[model samples]
Target: MKPTTSEMEILQVLWEKKSCSVREVHESLNKKDVGYTTTLKLMQIMLEKGLVVRDSSSRSHIYTANITEEQTQTSFLDKMIDTVYHGSTSRLVMQALGHSNTSKEELAAIREYLETLEKS
Candidate 1:
């Protein structure tokens, strides 16, 4: 399932921490002023969506993201390219570069990646 923005925030926490309790996730997201129960409910929903796995053997059930960050980002990028750019990867790249401040090093890295892709 594609995670909502709130769920994505929780997923980010899980990816960084590897595993955490609801309380830990709530604490880590202190900047948002979200209630503990709200965080808990979101996690529960994520569990139902198969976005996360919970270990309930312990007192504080630990949760970890079922999906990898790379996998999620690739899905998001693919959907964005298809929906927003009409399946044109070049259009997506052009728009992305046009909006951002592209550095020489970043360009060099992109070039290197393209070279690697060509080799593959």
Candidate 2:
């Protein structure tokens, strides 16, 4: 299941923290004006969706992401490549590189990765 924007935000926090209580998730998302209850509800919904798992042994109910960061990134990238880029990964890379303010170090890393891909 694709996670909503709110759920993604919560998942990012969970991924970073590895495990977190609702309050910790809320605090991580403090930049947004979302309420504690709203975060709680979203987490509960995510649990139901199998995006997250909760440890109910404690009173705080710590949550962890059921999916890995790499998994989520690959899923979204595959969908975007198929849909938005019309199944062209080169087009997606070209568009991304063209538009973004990619640093010299970043570009070098990308080049190195491309070289590795070519060798394989």
Candidate 3:
């Protein structure tokens, strides 16, 4: 399942830490300007949403991602491609290539990518 924006914020920290209690998650988020209770409720809601799994063996529930980082990114990219890029990966690639300060090596890599696509 995909997390909402707020929950995704918490999930990012959880992914980085591997596992963390609510307080640790809250403290990590506090560094990014989010409130403690807000992070708590967000994670609590995420637990209900099955975006995270909480270990209840301790007095404080320790949370871990039910979804891996790759799955999360793939989901996000799918949505963004469908919505923002009109389901066109080429459009996304073109936009990125045009927008960024890509080096010659990066351009050569992209050319190689296109050649591989053609060969396939």
Candidate 4:
């Protein structure tokens, strides 16, 4: 599913908070200066996009992510590396490593990720 920028923002919030009501989503979004109705409307549209689903049986409609975070990340990163990194994941990794200070734990996690990749 191709999410517009607004949809992506809403998805990011939903991913962080897990299940949430429209009011809760609105409040969290308003903290970022987005209007409440706008957030509500975007979430409604996101449902159409198949990125979110809402249950109305609850006190407030509890919204849940219909797409997994891994799926979203993989899709976005494929686009990102193709566009931003000019199709070079090696360049992306080199730049990320060179430009950012990765913590020891983060480095260990990266190593573990690479180890799993090698096994596959």
Candidate 5:
């Protein structure tokens, strides 16, 4: 299932922490000004949706992402490329590069990746 924006925020914390209690996620999301109960409720919903797995053995329930970061990125990117870019990866790349100030190092890394793809 595709996660909502709120769920993605929680997933970001989980991805960094590997596993976290609701309190940990709530604290990490403090900048967003989300309430603790809201965070807890969202995590509970995520668990039901199979986006996260919970360890209930302990006093505090610890949650971990059921999906890997790479998998989520690939899924979202594929959907975006197909729908938003009309299946044109070049269009997506061009639009992204045009709008953003990409660093020289980043551009070089992208070029290297392209070269590797070409060789393969």
Candidate 6:
């Protein structure tokens, strides 16, 4: 399932923390000053969306990402490339590079990856 932007934020917290309560999730995003109730509500919605699993056995429920980070990234990237890039990965790459200020080090890493791909 594709998570919304807000849902993705919550998933990121869960992915990083492994398992945490709503309060923990809220604290993680406290820099953004997001409300506790808002985070709670989003977590509930995420449970319904099958994006997270809640352990309600204890007083404070624990939440964990139902999907792996790589799985979600791959899904999002595949959909984006298919729709926005019209199924052309090279076009997507060019467009991304054209828009972003990629550092030389990052570009070198990308070049290395491309070389590996060519070798394969």
What's the best-to-worst order under TM-score?
Answer: 1, 2, 5, 6, 3, 4
Lowest summed lDDT across 10 adjacent residues in model 2 is found at: 28-37
For candidate 5, lDDT tens digit of each residue in 10-41? 99999999999999999988766667899999
Count of residue pairs whose backbone atoms collide, per candidate: 0, 0, 0, 0, 0, 0
Q: Which portions of model 3 miss their true places by more than 4 Å? A: 31-33, 108-120
Alpha carbon lDDT of each predicted model: 0.95, 0.93, 0.87, 0.86, 0.95, 0.93
lDDT of 4 by residue, 1-120 (tens): 778877776777889999898888777776666777888888888888789998999677899989988998899899999999999999999999899999999999999999999999
TM-score of each: 0.96, 0.95, 0.83, 0.79, 0.94, 0.90
User: Distance from true position, residue 101, model 6, in Å?
Assistant: 1.6
- Misplaced by over 4 Å in model 2 are none
C-alpha displacement of 69 in model 6, angstroms?
Answer: 1.3
Q: Summarize candidate 2's per-residue lDDT along 1-120 as a digit string, tens digits.
A: 888888899999999999999999999998666789999999999999999999999878999999999999999999999999899999999999999999999999999999999999
lDDT of predicted model 2: 0.93
RMSD (Å) of each candidate, 1 decimal: 1.0, 1.1, 2.2, 2.3, 1.2, 1.6
lDDT of 4 at 28: 71
* Model 3 worst lDDT run, 10 consecutive residues: 29-38
Residue ranges of candidate 4 with Cα displaced over 4 Å: none
User: How accurate locally is residue 67 in candidate 5, as Cα lDDT from 0 to 100?
Assistant: 91
Off by over 4 Å in 1: none
List residue ranges in candidate 6 displaced over 4 A.
Answer: 31-34
lDDT of 6 by residue, 1-120 (tens): 899998898899999999999999989876576789999999999999899999999999999999999999999999999999899999999999999999999999999999999999
Better-scoring candidate (lDDT), 1 or 3? 1
What's the distance in Å from true for residue 43, model 6? 0.9
Model 1 lDDT, residue 119, Cα:
100
